[model samples]
Target: MEHITSVHNPRIKAWKKLQRKRERDRSGLFLAEGRHLVEEALKSEVQVKVIIIEESVELPPEWQVSDVEVIEVPEKVLRELAETETPQGMTAVCERPDRHNLLLESGRFLLLDRIQDPGNLGSILRTAEAAGMTGVIFGEGCADPYNGKVVRATQGALFSMHVQQMDLEEAVDLCRENGVPIFGTSLSGSTFTAIAPQDSFALLLGNEGEGVDEALLEKADQNLYIPIYGRSDSLNVGVAAGILIYHLRGD
Candidate 1:
């Protein structure tokens, strides 16, 4: 196996660059840190170009890495590449899945608009995957799914879930054509419980502060809101998403 000791090594420098969204976008790759996320990437359709392991850390014996390039680096190098406070000693450079040709299907989906918080976006992705969402569509102003904080926050769900970035108006039209109902969450809408859960639908979630955009809400077949029974005026977007996703899934 190839070994690198210096953070200044050309390859190490490039790997570190993956921390930035612009670099990730230009290279069509992102870094997956920690053992669990690396394992998830290897198990999923994601193409892993390289696995970097700290020299002192031993990987699980059962991991099948013969087909992929492996590199050994010192603790300093791993720390330099890590986004978290504690380094996991394992990281993978993985190509972003090409989702351009992903088809719109008749199943549960989540549509997000202007979700600026990476942590919230990650939580939503994790919850959507857990709730058996077919896919997630990212509208304008949403945080990039490949952002390091977002990637780590998602645990391993980012690997298996299908996500796309597109104009939401187009996404709504496509969902409509596929026979999926578009339900936007807003304060003025009927209580969510009033609407009948369907096998196929798109739940539109919006920015943390703004709620759903007025234009998109107008386009929705129906707008619904979760009731706030307590003194709290609202729920976190991620929490609200979990409740609505499972409820709409009829689980």
Candidate 2:
């Protein structure tokens, strides 16, 4: 495989376009850079259409990206398509995650209500995957889960879980129709332990400042809060979300 010498190459142009969220959205595609993320995508069954690696970078045999075009690029050219400050010298164009069409068929779900920070959303996604969450739902007012920071935060769990966006009420309604309960964190409700673990439930998290929406709280099946002893007014959204996810996982 010849290494690309020209950053002006058409393939390079198309990938650079991915730096803009609109282009990624318009094409329903996103670029995951680095050896590990691409490898994880492959392991998680994501379709990799193009992989660009630096000169002489050896690949493990099981990478198994048979139909995908594997090409080498000059380190500078690879940097041109990269979003990171520290370029990893590898990148892969992947199909956008297709978890939207899925119903919350799994009894366990995480609902992020108007959770606006990309990093928080990303960390929550990673935690959800680690805590064995069945799926995640991002409702209105939440940041785009596919945003670059969020994508990176999930590590490769973005490929490992079912994630979808929806209206808050409709998402809660979907869970309700299937007989699953929804839990939201607040300053009051039952201590996490008091609520016995059910086989299925949705853990709802709200905006960092506003807490869960009043309408959503009205709709939720259980309003629960973490018992905080610290002087701080509330926990970070990511920390709060992690606590709830673990509790539901039966901590």
TM-score of each: 0.97, 0.92
Model 1, 9-35: lDDT tens digits are 999999999999999999999999999
* Candidate 1 regions with alpha-carbon error over 4 angstroms: none
Worst 10 residues of 2 by lDDT: 97-106
Q: Per-residue alpha-carbon lDDT of model 2 for 166-245, expressed as tens digits? A: 88788888888888888877786677777886778888899988989888888888898877798978789899888777
* Candidate 1 residue pairs that clash: none
Clash number for model 1? 0
Q: List the residue pairs that clash in candidate 2.
A: none
Clashes per candidate, residues 3 or more apart or on different chains: 0, 0
